[model samples]
Target: MNITISTFMKIAVTVIVISALLFSVGYQMVVDESNHYDSELDRYKNESLGR
Candidate 1:
């Protein structure tokens, strides 16, 4: 079996693109969850202080 340079480059590019996309999505999700937790913690603290 013989693989051409063009074919190899195409595969590499595809893998890289997919990896970048997944990383971006995962990073965004983590940021969103962190933000949510931060807000919740702030709310809890405010409630506690009001008592």
Candidate 2:
């Protein structure tokens, strides 16, 4: 019923790895969306600014 140090370490490591992977995927998704939005905004800027 009680967890040992090794067991706790293993669970902690697993949780960390899973969290990092999920964060990486979510971060990249936001980055991609931002990049897309920037390009679109640039197009509008160029058309309006006559640059």
Candidate 3:
């Protein structure tokens, strides 16, 4: 029983760590995409304004 519990705990911890890493990577990608979009928009706006 103790061995099983230990194995379960290890698996749970590994899953949690992997999940957290994936979430962070996904969030960073979203943020980078947003920033890129904003910059492109600004560039277009400046061109329209003849800046």
Predicted model with the maximum lDDT: 3
Model 3 is weakest, by summed lDDT over 10 consecutive residues, at 1-10
For candidate 3, the per-residue lDDT at 49 reads 100
lDDT of 2 by residue, 1-51 (tens): 356888999999999999999999999999999999999999999999999
For model 1, name the residue pairs that clash. none
Scored by CA lDDT, what does every candidate get? 0.95, 0.96, 1.00
Model 3 TM-score (2 dp)? 0.96
Tens-digit per-residue lDDT, 10-37, candidate 1: 9999999999999999999999999999
Error of 2 at 10 (Å): 0.7
Q: Give lDDT: candidate 2, residue 7.
A: 93
How close is every model to the real structure, measured as TM-score? 0.91, 0.78, 0.96
lDDT of 2: 0.96
Deviation (Å) of 13 in candidate 3: 0.2
lDDT of 1 at 38: 100
Off by over 4 Å in 2: 1-3, 49-51
lDDT of 1: 0.95
